[model samples]
Target: DDILPDGFTKVKPRKTRRNKTDTTGFPPLPPPKSQSETSHSTASDSNKQPVPNLSVTSTPSTSQVPEDTTAQPPRKVRVTPIVLRDASRWRGVNHKFISLGIKFERAVAVDAGIRIIPKSEDDYRRIIRLFREEEVPHHTFPLPSERNIHAVIRGVHATLSEIEIKEELQQRGYSPLHIIRLKRGGGVPMPLVVVILPKVEKSQQLFNEHELLGLAIRVEVQKNSRLIGQCHRCQKYGHAQSYCTAPPKCLKCASDHMIHLCPQTEQEERKCANCGGGHPANSRTCRFAPKKNLEVIAQRRNVSYADAARDATRAAPSVGSSANTQNVDLATALRSLQQIIGPLISATQALQAIFPANG
Candidate 1:
């Protein structure tokens, strides 16, 4: 090989290049279905249109709409963080933290720390200035505000379809949830529907039987588990972390390097991504995880998993269910399988969490 000119270096052409399409406009959309198809759809779904989902405002694709605040239920103003120096030796107090005519609902403790929930926006604003008091525990700012209510709907007949459920809810004149999913339990055709409600207030109404198209379905509303996300790699939420597309961050120190390759020698000095605390970010103990999870929730909602599993566009199972087998991607197939066994998997996970195997 001959010596190249100064600053010249050997170069190899990229073997793989993304195919670029030169076009001035987007491809044409599919033609609208005929009136017969529309009529048939209307008839099949009992003439009710899909209700407007409200929680989708967090998605990047969705623009926030101005709604009458007076019309809606009480909004979650913010989460105020508090830290107790002696978390283990702390005594439970019944009274609310009051200051300047402002009152916090209650102190929810985690470890030796607690987070205060102000009654409303007005209270939060009033207490904002005096929030960081010198006497009480350290009150932190900007906690995750979005709240979730998990409910398992029962008494839905095997024949009760997703479309019918949506139609029924819409007919009831309730603000529709962004996601109301039916997770199939085992080999059963009918599934247990897990609804993610936009408001915590919905939990009260759920205690009563919900009449969905003559089917008096009972909704058992419970607080969201707020379980740490299962990492795609490790399968446990608060364990080995995988950045996936990005470079892995150190689980201990939260540095630029991987956990194993972390150069910081002090193992005791752990820092979390969720909270600026001395612990791994993956730890379930991180009180800040819930707030961080709200962002994750918003990101996950981009895809309509329930509808994808339902595959309404595909021919009815009667015609030929296996017709699309050749065209299905790995993710789609996985999603379909997940839809079938999600309830079982969830229950199993819950059991596992409750009773971890002894090493």
Candidate 2:
């Protein structure tokens, strides 16, 4: 008991911290339960129903998940194009079609006439019937495509008429659309016929040789002539005016107008739309014209334009070399003639000398 001053007081001793396992500061816990009480509590818990946990979500297993089977989009349908020859009556024809509720894919104005694309074969047949009923001038020839097969039949006698050839082809279980005799440049008929056939599984059979009118005829696939299509409207190659989507271009002056609407006279200076030359767009002498043919051949043969051009260059004979070769041949011919003539002259002189006494 220490005495302190009037303004000061004695300090009490501080208590030490309790150990981590000590629970003296906290409220005393209940005593440990007996084994029987623990067993009873566990049994009660097992009998009680479990309350669903709203806060915690359980994800579904992969095996329990449903698969997605969404359908794919439909494929595009192919359309066939048909040309109408009478362009002047196209407006009336279009109006009539619309009035009749006739459905077509589309129609475009072309130099030949109106080119109408139909959605189905039924529509094509219907249009053809309508044209024939109306006495309209129209050509229904199919364009060169995979579906159209053209073959050349050689050794067909000119005396055999077209009707006879058609009959013969039909008798051979084959369908022939048109059989025309081929002709030379001067309209001289040749012993060859061009046959147009529809594409079928047995279309290749036409390439085999066949006997016709007691004469064996050879058949061959018609080779592509590498002919390019020139669009009269745009004055461009690789496409025709009927299917051309380009704007009109004048052939005479390369103006933005049709040939019939061109204001230039015959005496006016001509301008080409393709090469910008003095000639018209369709001139045969254009340097760029051969490129168009190459493009056509490349597309038909499934080759590149450069490769086609290289092949054409290799196939064409050199003019200078050909002329030199002709000159060499002529000189050789002259030398051979001189050698034969000299020997003959010497023999004739010797014979005359031997027969001098008789003279």
Candidate 3:
């Protein structure tokens, strides 16, 4: 048995190797350090955070954000609304402006004013600036009325009275309306050939839809006037068709016998080749012998071919007539047989009397 001294019986602890802090009686640990504090420290000092041990692992710290460095905030711009005024009543009109319920786009300012002159001028520039933009010039003008009087009078269709023409001019914006007197006669309707002349300044400033319309009316009237002298007799121009001096028949009628020729009169007259007479070439007696017989007969026939043809045509059955077989009735057959037998019996009796011994 292993014997121990009485004091040596207590168990002794293992001794560990000495650490760097063992002489100072403290445990070894990492130096406390931070990026911000290190950045604030002088470069000469070795105050940097300790580099992690090559073999040791460390828990990751929560993420940090850098301080903001922006100098100033952004600014917003202010916009004004635009409204159009004194615009041409006949000039340019916006579709969006007319349709108040539907929006064209976001609101934007636009320049608006009256540019047409003497009649209207700009008074609401502030409101005009609310529009986004102006449309391209259409160069359209308005129909004349009391407010814009004085228009050129164009020609008229159908029959128009002087009072009617004057009223039309007044409505078309004409001052001191003038009308060219229309010629009245010879198939042409009431035709006018004049235009109204407005004052110089206003006429010069305004566009010319009226003048163009007037000129067009004059042209149409002139063209129709030239056509009124046509002839109605021959259906040809230059004279009345009733009084046309063309041939007994027109060129077309003579060529094709169409139109103007009386159908009843034409059918009654026949065309002849031999004598050019309005009758058939061969007479009824001349055509009889050759058609009926090829053999030379002793009979001197008096009938003509034309007459025979006519007779044959009359004797022929109509379109839906039945054949000979359809006309053979049993009753008619019996009557014919009786008549034939009666004649035969009469002949036989006469023969018996002639030869009494044979009977």
Candidate 4:
């Protein structure tokens, strides 16, 4: 029994220590509060503002950032390699290329025709070699319109094999195929494939789609424009696939195997071996293709139809256009004639005044 002292009612005993094993069990769960208590807690939560759910993380505060006193070395820049895709349209264009949407990066190193802009402008430059698909005819001065056919190829199979697709087309009598292409990200095959046909008859002609491959594989003609003249076999620019002499290469990777034979998995990131880029080798985001298109467009805008017609009349006998040269020559001759006749006319008028004509 606990002791009792004066002025105290009673004394209680202190709690005894429990066995360690007693605590082995899980801690007691929170008790279920009374209805009033739960309602009050809910009310408190409702009264407070909800935190915003943002996808982007908040930036660290300035004080949270660590300051480094160590000196840092300069980082080496990796320059993008570039090539001219449409070399045929490069004719008659003089001095430096420019495009609004298209950007030209300075070259870091020169590989073949690809070059980095040197620090010194006065440095003696060797002739820059440009890559081309087919041999451009020297006589093609005005530059012929490109020839190409755009078609949408729908596949019966859920997954299409690019190499086998050709075999199916060959069976359907679509012979001598020039170019076949699908969009990027070939992880799961798409139902529709866009293709280019260089042998098409007309420009911007629409034709009905035809089924081939003994399957529901059908090709519908879209727009027929000038061929971009890219080589599917070599995965190179400037020549047609049919005329390609280089070894077989992948369009997606510029690899040794055919584009259909590439082993690129969906999990792996796409990369271009041609330009060393994140996109595929055949991507228009490539430096070459867009640059060529800009050059073609710029040349077209610079050379008017009337100028082209006049150019066709004269076989480029001089540096300047025939019409301009003729106008300059005529102006010079008129000035010379005026100068030669000025003294004679003045002398004749003076003699008439001296003689007092009809006195």
Top lDDT hit: 2
lDDT string for model 1 (1-359, tens) is 33468857767676896756748567656679999998898798885778778765545433555555687677754544333323432343222233245666765776424445666655664544443342333323333444455667777776777677766666665444643555442334454566555565644475575666777777786544554453322222432222222234556666666554756544246776446677665554456444445444444656354443334224222111233233345557789889989899899999999999999
Q: Between prediction 1 and prediction 3, which has the larger lDDT?
A: 1
Q: Candidate 3 has what TM-score? A: 0.15
TM-score versus the correct structure, for each prediction: 0.28, 0.38, 0.15, 0.25
Q: What's the CA error at residue 323 for candidate 1, in Å? A: 14
Determine the backbone clash count of candidate 1: 1
- By TM-score rank, best first, the candidates go 2, 1, 4, 3
In candidate 1, position 345 carries an lDDT of 88
lDDT of 2 by residue, 1-359 (tens): 45587756677898996745755767657789999999999999999999887885668989988987888789966566767766887878778777866678988887656778876667776776777787665544343343568899989988888899989888888888888898774456899999988787666688875777799989988987768766778776655665444557788888899987877755467888888988777765566575666677789889998887677655522212344446667887899999999999999999988888653
Go through the candidates in order and give the C-alpha RMSD of each one to the true structure.
38.8, 18.0, 38.6, 31.9
Better of 2 and 4 by TM-score: 2
Question: For candidate 3, lDDT tens digit of each residue in 45-160?
Answer: 56677776798655555554555688777663222222223344322344543453322223323233322211121212212322324432211122122122333234455466
Give the residue spans of candidate 1 off by over 4 A.
Answer: 1-79, 82-146, 184-190, 200-203, 223-227, 230-359
- Deviation of model 4 at 144, angstroms: 12
Model 1: which ten-residue window has the lowest total lDDT?
Answer: 315-324
List, residue by residue over 1-359, the lDDT tens digit for candidate 4.
54557655565778997745546567656779999999999999998999888779879989998898798998854322233333333432113333212223353322223333322222112112212323322111111233355677776454556667667655545543443444433234456666555554532232444555566555577653443656666655655654333457665555787766877643345666467666666665566553554345446669754554445335321222345446767887899999999999999999998897794
